[model samples]
Target: MNDNTSMGNGASQQNHLNGQWQGQPGQQGQGQYGQYGQPQGGYQQGPPQGGWQQAPQPKKKNWFLRHKILTAILALFLIGSIASASGGGSKGSDSASSSDNSSSDSAAKSDDKKSDEKKSEKKDEEKKDEGDKLPAVGTPVRDGKFEFTITKVERGKTTAGSNEFLQETAQGEYTYVYVTVKNIGDRAQMMSESDQKAFSSTGQQFSTDTSASLALDGDNDFFLTDINPGNQAKGILVFDAPKGTKLTQIELHDSFLSGGVKASL
Candidate 1:
C-alpha cells in the first residue's frame, strides 16, 4: 500500500514540470529541462527550408553611371565647345593671314606703279633730249660774243698763202672753211683762227693752220682781228689734214676760252 502511494506522487510531479515547460496559460514559470537535455527556453532549432541566410544590403551605383543621359549631354557639350573654339581660332588666323597678304599686295602694287611712273618720266626726258639738237650749217649758231654762219668748204690743196714770203705749205693736205662772223655783244671780240676745229667723217680732229692765212688773197681778216659790236667780218680757216680727209663739221669759238658752237659742213 505505501509503494503505490510513492509512484502516484512522482507521476504527479512530472506532469506539473511538463505543464510549466509547455508554457500553459495561468501557469507559473519554472526552470525546466527538455527531452534533449537542454534548458527549455534555450533550445536551438534548425532553419526551416534552405541554408542559413542574412538580410541582403542593396548595392550602390556610381553617380556618373546613374545619370547616364546627363553625363552624355555634358560630354557632348564639352566636345562641341572644343571643336567650335578650334574652328573659330583657325578661321580667325586665316582671316588675319589674308589681311596681311592683301596689304602686302597693295604695297607691291604701289611700288610697281611708282616704278612704272619713273620709267615713263625717264622716257619722256630722253625724247626731249633727242629733240634739242644743235643747228646745222647756214643756220646761224652763236657763241659767247659772236654769231657765225658757215658758208662753204674747200678741200685738197698742197700749199696756202698767196704771199711767197709768208706762204705756208701743208704737211698733209689743206682744207679751207669760209665763215661769216658777226659780233652781237656790246664790246668788241677778237676772232681767233686757232679756236676753230674741224672733224673728219671718222671723227678725226684737225686744227687750223694760222700761218696759211697769209697765203689767202683779198679781204681775209682771220688773223686775230677785233670786230666791233653790230659789225660783220668774213674769215677763212685753213686746216692741214691727211689726203682725201673729208671734214664733216666745224666748231667755231669767239675766243680761245669760249665754248664753241658746232655746225655741220
Candidate 2:
C-alpha cells in the first residue's frame, strides 16, 4: 500500500506540471493580442491632436503667400507711377522755359524797331529845319516901277532893233539899285509916239497901256510891267555878281519924280 500511494503522488505531480505548461502559452498569446488592440485607440487620439496643429499651419501659409504677392504688385505700381510723374514734370518745365525765352526775344525786337523808327523821324525833322533857312526867290519891288537890290549880278543878251539913245550903252554894275517910274497920274495914261517907241525899245512890247501890261527893254532885254497906284509891278534886272543873290533894298516912284530910287531885293 505504501508503494502504491507514492506512485500516485508522482503521477499527480507530473499532470499538474503539464497543464501549467500548456496554459502559459495561451495566456502569453492573449496578452500580445490585447496589447495590439490598445495601440489602435492610442493611434486615433494621436490623429485628432495632430490634425488641429496641421490645420492652422496650412491657413497661415496661404495667408502669407497672398500677402507677399499683393505687396510686390503694389511696389511695382508705385515705381511705374513715380517714373511717369517725373517725366511729365520735366516736360512741363521745358515748355515753360521755351515760352519765356520766345516772349523775351519778341519784346527785344519790338523795342529795337521802335528805337530805329524814332531815330529816322528825328533825322527827317532836322533836315526839314535846315531847308527852312534858305532865302526866298521872286520878291516884289514897287507898286508901279520895280527895282532890284542885287547881291549878285549877271549879264544877259540885249533884244534886237532898239534905239541906242541912252549914253550908257552897257548896263551899270550895281550891288543894289532902285528903279523909279511914274504912274499914269490919270485914271489912264495915253502912250505918246515917243513913249511907245521908247517902250518898244524893251524886248517885249506892251499891247495896251493897261495896268497889267508887260514890256521888255531892248537894251538889256529886261522884263517890265505897268502898274497903277497900289498896283504891284515887277521887272527883272541882270547882274554880274555872285550865284546866290540876296537883295537888300526896294524903291518906288513918287508922283512928281520920273527917276526911280534904289530898292532892296
Q: Residue 234 of candidate 1: its Cα lDDT? A: 96
Put down candidate 2 lDDT per residue, 78-130, tens digits, no spaces: 99999999999999999998999999999999999999989877865653443
Q: TM-score for model 2?
A: 0.26
lDDT of 1 by residue, 52-101 (tens): 78999999999889999999999999999999999999999999999999
Candidate 2 Cα outliers beyond 4 Å, as residue runs:
1-70, 130-265
Q: State which candidate has the highest lDDT.
A: 1
Instruction: Give the C-alpha miss distance for residue 61 in model 1, angstroms.
Output: 91
Candidate 1 stretches with Cα past 4 Å from truth are 1-134
Clashing pairs in 1: 161-215, 162-215
